[model samples]
Target chain A: MAFGIGSGIFFAHMPFLKLNGIPGTTYRVMPGLISKRLTNRLGINFQAESFGNNRQKGMDELDRVLDRGFPVGMLTSVYYLPYLPKAFRFHFNAHNLLIYGKQNGEYLVSDPVLDFTTTISPKDLERARFPKGVLAPNGRMYYPVSVPEKVDFNPAIKKAIRWSGFENIMTPPFLPFFGSRAINYMANKVAKYPTAMDERKAILFLGNIVRMQEEIGTGGAGFRFIYAAFLQQAAKRLDNPELSLLSKEMTGIGDQWRDFAFSAGRICKGRQAGNEDFKSIANLLMDIGDKESAFFHKLRKVKM
Target chain B: MKANEVPQDDSGVIGGKFTGLKYATDENGNYVEVQSIGWDAEITVLSQAWDEVNEQAKEALEKVKAGQWSTLAYHSTKCMMNEAMLSEYMDMSKAKVKEHLYNPAAFAALPAATKEKYAEVLNIDLNELLRAE
Candidate 1:
């Protein structure tokens, strides 16, 4: 079974039939394991080194490797990979990909995570973190070999190397933050109108609150509490001829739906459940809210 | 005539361009012209308070961008709703309502009012709660 597994792993790393006639070097290494099989096949002598489980050490190792004119490739856990420099260019969480390559005085990279390949100027690479400077104390660094050009580097390996440049790129602000900003912007807009449109404004505010809760995983509890308060306030300001019992009933139903969703499952778990799951749920909830908000926004436009 | 004394006319005819000259009779019976040039200056400085406010807002927006608000909201809600439910209930003022009503040793202690309200709303008590038992 072990031999079969080894053979399967080996064949998996081999270039497909299309790559057979292609020129260039190819190397593959599984995460957390040394690429002895790939090294033997390439007929290259390479050494493996690990930065003592911290970003600073990793950064230092990165500087040392680049200073010595040797290129480095890293394979690390998903959590650590995103925090590294040039993370967007590489798939730090994946099976196999290179992080750097050189062609015609330009360095090209293919990051599997971002699913994109780009060529960066030599100047940029020189200023790059892993290649030019020390790693953070908590960062991790892995290099396949200490020597340059000993292994026949294939396009796949080149692509993977190029891709690793995107490790630790900053992610954009999340949808929730945008939703909050949108809510605040809309609230300030509503506040400018006079007393005659107070009910309408309150309704719009409630609608936005609902939208925010739904879209950003802001949660039904907070929205429900706020909506209830808004409704009570709107009841005192009921001067509109259009305000009717049916409108209140509909709003009530919406609130009930939100409450049901909020209390539906074990929504409130402790820290032990893992942050990733919570983030996933928050993202999913935000997506749903954003869709709902879009529907309501269209409705509001039609009303206007 | 010497170049310096070529033409001292108030009229702009001596030069191709117009000139700022005023002619007057001198004590020595020679015509003299006075010329003057005008200049203006202005200065402005930005307010430090405005810059500080702008910087603060930018930092707040960045923190929001970094997912700080969402993280805080998630943790706060979890603490308030889940963990707080398992502890002994206390009043809004944090005063103990009853000996059995509030369990200081519970996983998440809460004020009596918040506990009672949550318990009443959630339909669970200390004995029936999973985290408490």
Candidate 2:
């Protein structure tokens, strides 16, 4: 997995978008952003391409890549990967994994969501790669066609820091559902769930938030830890002790996010006190939003 | 998020069980990457949350078997769409999609363009879509 130069860079800017009429919420990065950032920063020939609604063509491309000894990254729905435990299965179509090789009709998969590498039959893999939903994978995949023999980490880290900072702070507030504004937007909306929805529906909604934060791959805490890892790597690469200090601070912030998830989980299981209603949940989120806001503010001002 | 904290329980372990890398605190209390076995409490609730989704999908499939709903219902369930999302994908009104869910005969009478749209959105062959899955 590409850590420092991948999702880690976009950590603080990840947003939550709540549809006006839909019951679901999203806390994921938009597809293709990772490849875009990687390509730009690493100066590699990386392309995020889709197979144009043709399953057979997509499968052919996947095989062609594997034949070339290139591990192809694919977008897949979580529910169709039979190798996954039932407990971790969902209809989410944006889960990502890499197919590196095949043996005995089973593809070797490196799913970032999983703790270890696994194999899947081609039939089951096909079902996973083509599940229907918004932003359908349609056999979408990405890979770097060319990579420089030598690369510099310092400049790349600096670029990532600048882009991530700009994207988070400068995101248009009018969108109301993205960037920092999204945190408050979601918090306000969450505050009303207790009165607006029945007990069952309210619990479901809360459960969804926790799942978005903690489940479906790297829980929210994982993102923070990933970013901290990036900072630590960046610090070592650049020999910048300040960046090391920042990494520790980010780790602390990650702990806060974990704490929020734990609180939300308690509420979901009805283990919390009566006062831990929607308002309290919203308050917890607001606390997170505040800390993150301040963290990014300091991040943007850090001198390389 | 540390390696030591990665759960060892089987509840949310994805893709059969395997050990993977996790970040954990070292003796110095600083974070370092280490290999660890898998367990995630988040997956426990996540799996529980899907009960309602699976229930809805199963019910929709039953409607297909009973011939009260078209195979589109089953495909929609497979696609993890509710009526509103299906309506958006099929370009039909939500109420219209719900009506079709209850009246297979009416759905069968839909325009070719509408049927084709549903097939395309569901990523299924149009011919196969007309029949039961």
Candidate 3:
């Protein structure tokens, strides 16, 4: 999995940063890191550019690159992308997509999560590229500059897996809002939300979490599940039985995350039956945190 | 998840407007791309979010009907924008945007060109900018 090889699975529950008035949780590394880390690990020559205040110059450069027949990745805001579903468009500035070709004043877009390719008008694309505030894209784009003819995969996969295993398993004690710790941290915080915050805000906060978890681009699965898929593929090539077993366990953990989303969704919809309240969901999160804590540690010890 | 096990439960929230790709195990136990027509959990959560947004817009529309807030307030809330964002887009200070949203006297004193700017940014005509229909 390019995702796991890039250490994409993470958990961060941020209360200090507010998004749309909801305290948000981030499930992956920052927007650009996965590709950056993955390319670096694979020794691929990658080139990226940011236009800063020079957007027209950025567009010209983008045109120049596309003229050379390279599809470039761009950081964009979802809110101005008219091709997205009405339900999916928000002021989110970290959405990434590919611009492959231009035709008749529209750019051909291969948005990562969508089932089909779409097109965006130049003006709309410009609006999506420059949403103000909070991790603004600033007309950023990246493309691979060159590719190596030969490479070894087994060692690279093992190194990446081990590195990511430690990354998820070893967040420090003081910054409790990070890594697997945040899963447990949120488990504790969910209990206080009902009493600490107003009813609507509490519900919206949980909804925001669910949005991050099941966001359409994640292929309707948690990163753990995606990582598990990666592991299964890797195990076959590596002939590693231990990884196969852990992959199954990771799938189970992913199921638990879906259960969390289900229970939290019920609460947000005001359909929580007798057992679907905050306490039960908090317990569910604790159970998930424990499983993940054990899983990552074991993953770190895998013989590779 | 296995290909067959992927949820087909429609939450009545997209109604076929959107489809996403999922990674699921194929019959041979290899991973493959499986298109999903929205999952139950995601639909439930996103519906709650949209409900809140639309509900707030409705309340703002009511407030506009009652002459409590200017139509700028109604348009901004309906578009899921806050004063900070609107201010940035309008190139006005946040306090000035607040006045445009709330203070009837300040809004009424706006010149035609200023109103045109708001109308353009909000993607509404001059008539729609005057009041919420």
Candidate 4:
């Protein structure tokens, strides 16, 4: 599954990187990276371009691609996508959507977060594509020109798992903004929030953590459940019982991740859910960090 | 999570207009994709983040109203951006961005072309931007 092979599980709580004055806390890497990883694994021939400072060129290229009846993936600023529910449309610039066709000057869009496909006017699409800010897409459009047939899945699956292992567990711990170490690093930093910052700001940081974890298309727990589900499917396909066992454990861990979210929510909302405070919340993250480190370590050793 | 265990609570800020896809296991212990309406805890945290944005925007609006800062401060906060990002988006130096955001005089003295550029990037009309509200 793309979820496991995408190698996107990550953690960061950098005070330097500010998102609307809230300290940076992310659960994954850059957007669209999962599909990029999938394309690489599939050996698919894809053409992706960033039309910086040339909006019309990007639009013309998109029309040309769609005239050939190919769906194109576009990196956009979610805030400008009027088709999206507006209540939560922040200034995220890396949201990916598919543009399959143009009719009556509106581009037919298929966003992963939505249940049904939507349409965007050309002007709105241009704004979404060229919107400025951090991680701006610069009118990026990507589509696969060719996908090879008769490709084997075993090697791809193994390679992806190994890559995730290295990316998640084996990254050097000295770098405190990535991998299992970052999870621990955040856990430790979060414990100091109350003492280091104002109470309201500290709570806002916790709320930001939960928002970053569950927001968008992540299947909860910074994608632990999705990864578990991926492992289960891979187990059946590869006929490996060990992966299934790991999948079950991962599911349980995903449940723990949910526990962390719900408990943190209670604290943020000030609902007084059994005295669940910042220290306990930090402990929960520390626990998840330990389990994830162990899980990835075990995964690196599984004889695929 | 099992297929049936997928939360159907559509109580998020998105309301029920859209659904999110989540991965779950079926009765056969096989993986399946499930559509989730949303979850309450997720809603709580998400709303809190947005509320912070709204609060900061509200505070900046007050400052702009009091002539303490330029409308850029209010617009930047309302658009969920900060001084650095406003600079990055407008392609101006950080010092100028800070000056234009904090000093009404700097914002008033901006050239018409630069003001139009700011309006375009901020998704506001040139007239609305000139009105400083």
Candidate 5:
């Protein structure tokens, strides 16, 4: 049910970049923004509202919605979600999940990051919804206020493709921390980790990238596979074989991301050395940047 | 992303948190249903992060015991937060929160309304908020 939301289905957010000497450069455009953009473009009627300071009222509204048979999308802190394994939990607060129904005192949850649905107590749900962090959920929730019986697919597909491709490849010159440039910026920062911070800190930093990519549903391969899936759908919808080929290429790029994560993991565990230095890691990232740059560059030129 | 690949072994740590029904391809490349049990490496990383939090909580508890910081500080750390985070959560200015951290007497004397806000934000009871431990 949550998969119908366009954010995770379309472009995967690649928001791991920072300005030099700046702390907390890890930011994404986020699912909320994407949902808004896609829904607006497709003219799919939806409403995403933040409950802000009145969390009790938010809970009431969520109960009302669930009673009305709408599975509501909610922003929450992964760390406070008690159902998640403690080892998989982190401070990230922008995690999205669906609250479909309630029984007894527990809310049925459909977390996109997981492979199966789960349940959470109202108390834990409340805690997860309101967590202290950089990107606190603030009791934010979204739902499809209304959806079209039939979607006009051609324009939607074209627009989504164009928007995603342009956003990732041809980001404005003023925004240095975007698109391929952001990847380059991250590569530079990662290369300096060994010298810029203590050894243990450096490895933790490496581990965080893996955590973001694989553990937190950041899309295994930084969202390349999801984008590929989107392209695959586009290929079928538009009857364009080029898109299918591009999807295969994107999947290969996703493989590269997995490889990077695997290497990073080994280094974090101190199991691999001699060839897994910071420089090599940086180079691997640059290779991804190159492939992504080429892919998006070509994607933007698709005739549709 | 296969049913067989889902690790059922939860020998040493917590398990049984079901995600959702996932789709995987069989040997014939046809879609199949699978239930992901949870990734082991991701759990290990989460455990490591929790250990760090536990260490911080222990330090904060000692400070509370010594009257160097308010019990609120220790509780905040226990909630996986620091002063900056607690300030954000409580919707109080960082400077004010920091002041409260240093002055347990003042914190204890705060209005019930304000105390309630802290307890609610931390997802704890009022008694737990005031407790020294």
Candidate 6:
């Protein structure tokens, strides 16, 4: 029933997997929160192998099973290659995915990275090698294998593999979920609303403004320093005694504000200085601001 | 539909002026689309710069030149992805932009010098670019 529920949802959502595709499953050896969510949805058992120990022991256990002619499922390597007995070296990353049923003297393997369903001959499996640094200090790998029957539970082994309480196989990664697509479609629909567009434009403008500030800290340092020096000179220009003392003070403050504003403008200008997207977006914002100001002026005139 | 009507389909939205201008037809008959202008342009610029620096570095094999190239590329990419103009144009989430740029497949086609040039133009580090898994 558990498998049925998971499979039903998985199969329903991702019909693309059935189009000239092989049936397969996915599992995470060391399940993180995201992996746990996947497990719940897919009904896959979370078999947690330790990065520190037990991985070698698990590999050994797998080898024993393979020797007994039990169909092997893909091994999920959380960290480092499990120490499989020499006979199983052929399966290292080659028949990396084990098949439950053989059609043409080859096991169908599902590769996550390759995004293709591959059929590997036993000879090819023999020559397959683990990735470089697979045996190193902190390397991690995950494999999916075919099993003769549901994985038998040795209490300790089950405990080691059961990172999460859930236990069911998951659909392969290539499967598409209709629910997600639907949600995305709806979101794109909502984005077309004028209010949403305006909000997006505003947020984009604000984000650009913030980014411009950060750029000045990096590549715009020269311009910033020059702008600062210019402000200092402007401040010095307010040294006229002929003007009222308060006027002179006001002039100094004005000069300081001018410098600050100029520095800010320089930083903003420097951000999209050469980038066309920035130029366009900046122009759009300016146009929007101008239109808004004009609208306000027209409203005031009408009120008068 | 009226000109101001909200676009209900991909074609309507995609054909809109803002989005339409983002793509262009190249001489090779491929549609070259600008995913993110500021960020891509910055990368192009940094990549160009790195090409020069790398040519000199290869002759001298100077670590400093290499380091400068790396820093330039890294800073630019980071700035581009994190900053507003480039980030907004990204097809994926903002967080994923950095990862996408770092992906090996993205640079697989470029030669070492060309890749370095691209990094310089983008204001990123070559080592960092290569290291992106």
Instruction: Give DockQ per model, in order.
Output: 0.01, 0.29, 0.63, 0.72, 0.28, 0.03
The segments of candidate 1 whose C-alpha lies over 4 angstroms from its true place after superposition are: A1-30, A79-97, A101-109, A113-115, A118-140, A144-304, B1-133
- Docking class for candidate 4: medium
- In the range A1-304, model 6's lDDT, one tens digit per residue, is 1211122111021223221121111111221333334444444544433233334544455444445555444433211122222211211121234434344766555543223355655433322322211221111223233223453322222222222222212223343332212212222322332343453332233232223222211112112222222222322343422222322232232233223233333433344332343334444333322332332232223210
- Poorest lDDT segment (10 consecutive residues) of candidate 5 chain A: A18-27
Q: Write the per-residue lDDT of candidate 5 for residues B1-133, one digit (tens) a residue.
A: 3335433434244456544233433454333445445455554444544556777789988888988888788887787666677788777889999878778888888999988888886778989988866
lDDT of 6 by residue, B1-133 (tens): 0112212222221122211112222343222322211222222222332333344435332322343333222433333222222233332354444433344344354568755654543335777655422
The candidate that wins on lDDT is 3
lDDT scores of the candidates, listed in order: 0.30, 0.68, 0.83, 0.82, 0.68, 0.30
State the lDDT of candidate 4 residue by residue for A95-120, as single tens digits.
88999898888999999777788899
TM-score of chain B of each: 0.20, 0.72, 0.90, 0.91, 0.75, 0.24
Estimate, for each residue in B59-81, the C-alpha lDDT of model 1 and write its tens digit.
54454345442222222122222
Ranking by DockQ: 4, 3, 2, 5, 6, 1
User: In candidate 3, what are the lDDT values of residues A90-188, reduced to their tens digit?
Assistant: 789899999999998789999886767888888888877877767888889999888788866777789888987898879889888888878999988
* Cα lDDT, model 1, residue A129: 26
> What fraction of the correct interface contacts does each predicted structure contain?
0.00, 0.27, 0.60, 0.84, 0.21, 0.00
What digit string (tens of lDDT, one per residue) describes model 2 on residues A1-304? 2455644433222234332122554443476676676677788887667876577888888888889888889889887787776656666778889999999888999988666789998877886787655667887888778898877657877777666655555667676566555666777777877777676666676667666555534534646676777777777778888778888877777777677667677676663324347788788778776766666666677788
lDDT of 4 by residue, B9-89 (tens): 767477676777777788887768887778887888888777888888889888899998888788777777677777877
lDDT of 1 at B4: 32
lDDT of 5 at A43: 78
Note the chain A TM-score of all models in turn: 0.27, 0.88, 0.96, 0.95, 0.87, 0.22
RMSD of each: 30.6, 4.8, 2.1, 2.3, 4.4, 26.1
Superposed by TM-score, candidate 3 places the C-alpha of residue A132 at a distance from the truth, in angstroms, of 1.3
Docking class of 1: incorrect
For model 6, the docking class works out as incorrect
Q: In DockQ, how does model 6 score against the reference complex?
A: 0.03
For candidate 3, chain B by itself scores a TM value of 0.90
What's the lDDT for candidate 2? 0.68
Better of 4 and 6 by lDDT: 4
